[model samples]
Target: TWSTDGVINEYCEPCEAIVEGELVEVPPLEEREEFSLDGVTYEAFNTSGGLGTLAETLKGKVRTLNYRTIRYPGHAAIMKALLNDLGLRHRRDVLKDIFESALPATLQ
Candidate 1:
């Protein structure tokens, strides 16, 4: 998603590089009014697969059903800024080129 959406310019040996570091605790969420247009609107958090699975089952039974994407809150904003504000969407090709050049495919 990051690559396709232009949020990330590349993919590296994620499982290896990331797993090498010790797990770090993220600090608590601080309320920020700037993060929202309406307080009710939220980035879909922990709802990605739920929506996919429930979609058909609740199709005609419900008029309004919404599922949020599984995200770590601030992730959406960072992504939105990367994809929308940074104009990466328009420069996906160059972004991909840079990413592919940097990231390793696999290790033996």
Candidate 2:
């Protein structure tokens, strides 16, 4: 679900196990890659999203799978700075305020 404050809260059925982690610097190859889909160019980078859960469920079933998040160029770096360098991850309220104020919602 999404909040008016520009925060997206997600919920899912409890997994048998949950993966906990911290953000880490992505390798160059995984940091930025360009791809074309449906005549539109996009940038992608490795992110610690739901891959851990998927990996746990697919253990031994698939040889390998790579997961990435598509985002605007430089978006990862900015997020890293906000959530890691600036230590906003520990203060979600501040982060939400920043998002709500600095970034106006857009249909596009």
Candidate 3:
């Protein structure tokens, strides 16, 4: 799901059927919240990361299955600005170029 080239696909092709069957959808960006772990607080928000497939496979076996992507504070805001405010969502090639150019690969 992640790549050193900065082009990560968030959706799993194998999960598409499960997602459609379950009507799974990502929550609104405004619903994002912060959580603390090891004294560090990070922002998390629901995304189409293929949780529905796992949920469907484990139906009745587990009480719940939820998935979210975690990122540094304000990361979501920047994404919202780029994808919504600047209308980059419809222009993914530009967005991908921006990401590849601005975000350097890190070992950490």
What is the lDDT ranking, best to worst? 3, 2, 1
Name the regions of candidate 3 deviating beyond 4 angstroms.
4-23, 27-30, 59-63, 106-108
Alpha carbon deviation, residue 45, candidate 1 (Å)? 5.1
User: After TM-score superposition, what is the CA distance of residue 77 in candidate 1 from its true location, in Å?
Assistant: 1.0
Model 2: how far residue 63 lies from native, Å: 2.2
Please give the CA lDDT of all the candidate structures.
Answer: 0.39, 0.53, 0.59
Minimal lDDT window, size 10, model 2: 8-17
Candidate 2 lDDT, tens digit per residue, 1-108? Answer: 335332321111111222233222233214468888898787875544335666666555665544566766676677768766888767777877887888767674
- Can you write out model 3's per-residue Cα lDDT over 1-108, one digit (the tens) per residue? 456222234421112222334533444344588999999999976555446467668655655455667888997788778777988767777877887788776665
What C-alpha lDDT does candidate 1 achieve relative to the native structure? Answer: 0.39
State model 3's lDDT.
0.59
Best by lDDT: 3
lDDT of 1 by residue, 27-68 (tens): 111112223444544444221223334545655555544433
**TM-score of each predicted structure versus truth:** 0.35, 0.55, 0.68
Off by over 4 Å in 2: 1-31, 37-41, 48-53, 106-108
